[model samples]
Target: MGNRQSVVREAARFAEWVLREVGRELRVARLIAGMTQGQVAGVLGTSISHVSRVEHGLIKGAGLVALSRHAAVVGLKPWIKLYPIVGRPLDRAQLALFAKFRDRIAGTWRVTLEAPMPIPGDLRAADALLAMPGCQCMVEIITRLADFQAQVRMAHRKQRDIGASRLILVVAGNDTNRRAVRDAGAAVRDAFPLDTRATLAALTSGVDPGADGLVLL
Candidate 1:
């Protein structure tokens, strides 16, 4: 009985912390980009209330379609994807692969994470990501990689500087699951000059304690 009480208390504390952290990130990003709440809300096709809920972590559940849209307004490159775990144990390959770009995305970056498998009830992947050392704007991109590709392509076609400032994708996968990602990088590079020199070789299996994949800018 005592343990149960502790667990409940811990869960409540975690929820509160997540809400406060997300609020801080949203506020900071909105300010940094010199964009207003109304403007951000417009981009999201939502009212101030919905955006407020998201920033406050009041959101409880999301579908693939909804997540894709929300991530877009948050101004991160959004994808819809499911992935089985890949890479070496501890599954830090992707982080290592993306290491060279870490510093840029660490603080200002926003992210959308997805789990291919049925996620545990207790694990809020999005919030956990926000808690990562340098993660900011972390949201979950739910569905298939193809969906995510389409989202990015649309953002690229519709927006002036799509994905230039965001660390768009973060799923649990490895080299096998990264082909589409590589192609997307190529497509983005073709359209504009980004820091494309970094390659997968530079990364090692490690965690990016601090990073954000999706962003306002």
Candidate 2:
């Protein structure tokens, strides 16, 4: 319970930090495009104050529609880069593993790496989206498990957008990762069963895994 709350709180803080940085970047983009707040407002069909609020991060939970339109006019594309929850140092190692994992099964599955789903508020970049004959699967790579609850929440959210028949949480093969999975308890298992063999077999055989599961690499 304490772990769950801590995970949720950290996820919320990370989200807030991303929003602040987005606001700052948007302001910089506006400047770079040589557009004032008023100009952006005019293009967005809103008041200059509204544009100012957005630029200043005063607007809460800004949707993708507004963001896309504003960026299109200002010659800036709104994008979010996904980094391991553990931190940037894990980026190269984690991403490489994710790619290799995808490549290993690519002979059988049609895999899309770093697939983007523009879901407002729950925007996520799927590390791998695997498609076989009948099933579409969302594969997420976790080098280190920072937050199980947050990971579950995100997988649930992304499932709708990815339209996956199943979800697989792929974790790096390490002591820390294995311990985190062990500590995740029954609820996490209920959501994502730790069954790498079943997942791999399903991918290889082009059949559905029948439920959410784990893939250890």
Candidate 3:
């Protein structure tokens, strides 16, 4: 309940910030176009006070149609862009890459796809879990690696929570991911000591790589 409330509060704050920014831009455009609040309101068939409130971002329920009308009156264009939400559902490419990794490791070890975390009520799950005679490995597969540090921290947290003996980060062997790993350099090395070759060798041989590994699929 607390977590949900916190998320709602954060979202409200972000929406307020965006509204203020948009209002500021509209105010500037109106000024540059030599239009008064009254003039804009007249064109939009609304009152000057309503226009003032909208421009000041004081009207929390200002609709897009009203905003667009105001922008049109001020010789400005209103547009919105959508971005992928953090931890969004996997796309086709990502799912395919996961399948490839699963096939590679399934031959040698017991592989569980989308294995739940050990902690009760924790919705998060490891992308894959690999088990051998004396080892349990938690795996995170990335089709396109972004925010390297955040990914590392998440992997570590999952490993600790699940009490896995080993952790492996499997990424698609594309040039983009390769470059990302290269740019990360020492940080990547420090987190996952085993490189592609060594990691694969250990996985195939059912041996604990002795440390966390970064494997390219």
Candidate 4:
């Protein structure tokens, strides 16, 4: 009973912390824009009481999407980042692969980890970001092709804001993943052209891949 009580306390604290942080950001934005609570409420199509409740953290279960709409009216863009609390083992392996990729390509392009993306709940983290003389590329390291379509769609949305000249997916050389990609058919192929040889050559020759594609590294 004591342990359960402690866990409940911890959860409540976390919730309060999140609410405070979000409320603070909203307050700051409103102040910066020189907007009154009533004005913000008007824009949001809500009553002044509702806006006050939100600012005071009295509102419960208000999603980021609703907040974002309110923010947009006040010249603010609210972005919330959502990620797994504990990464899977496959994710750890991908990080190692990302390191290898960086080591091999660092001479030619500047590499960064966990790049920013415009989309909410889809942080610009495709393992690594490679910026070169003329173009930038997002590199994704894949060990499995589970939910391949969703992954591609998310990457596509990320590219809209990332301004990546090329999108590269490096699949761990495995039969299962290869077959999965093959089964994805035209959708995957259209998104990522296969240029295994070009990708490998570019890493050595200090040139970017000729086009966006998949490379078995």
Q: Which candidate has the top score in lDDT?
A: 3
**Per-model root-mean-square deviation over C-alphas:** 14.9, 12.0, 12.4, 6.9
Predicted candidate 2 versus true structure: per-residue lDDT over 1-217, tens digit per residue: 8877876887877677666677788889889988888888887889999887777777777787887887787787877545333221336877887776765564777777777766444435777788888888888778878898887787777777768888888888888887887888787668876478777776666677888888878
Q: Report the C-alpha lDDT of model 4 over 128-214, residue by residue, as the tens digit.
A: 678878878887778777888887776666666667888888777679887887788897768777566667667657677767877
Off by over 4 Å in 1: 56-71, 76-217
What would the per-residue lDDT of candidate 1 be over residues 36-88, giving only the tens digit for each residue? 77888898777888777766767755344664565455554443333222111
Model 4 spans with C-alpha error above 4 angstroms: 1-48, 55-90, 99-106, 118-124
In what order do the candidates fall by TM-score, top score first? 4, 3, 2, 1
In model 2, the runs with Cα more than 4 Å from the true position are 1-90, 103-106, 118-123
Single out the weakest 10-residue window by summed lDDT for candidate 1.
196-205
- The TM-score between candidate 3 and the true structure equals 0.57
- My TM-score estimates for the predictions, one after another, are 0.30, 0.56, 0.57, 0.61
**What C-alpha lDDT, on a 0 to 100 scale, does residue 49 get in candidate 3?**
92
Tally clashing residue pairs in candidate 2. Answer: 0
Q: Comparing candidate 1 with candidate 2, which one achieves the higher TM-score?
A: 2
TM-score of 1: 0.30
Tell me the number of clashing residue pairs for each predicted model: 21, 0, 0, 0
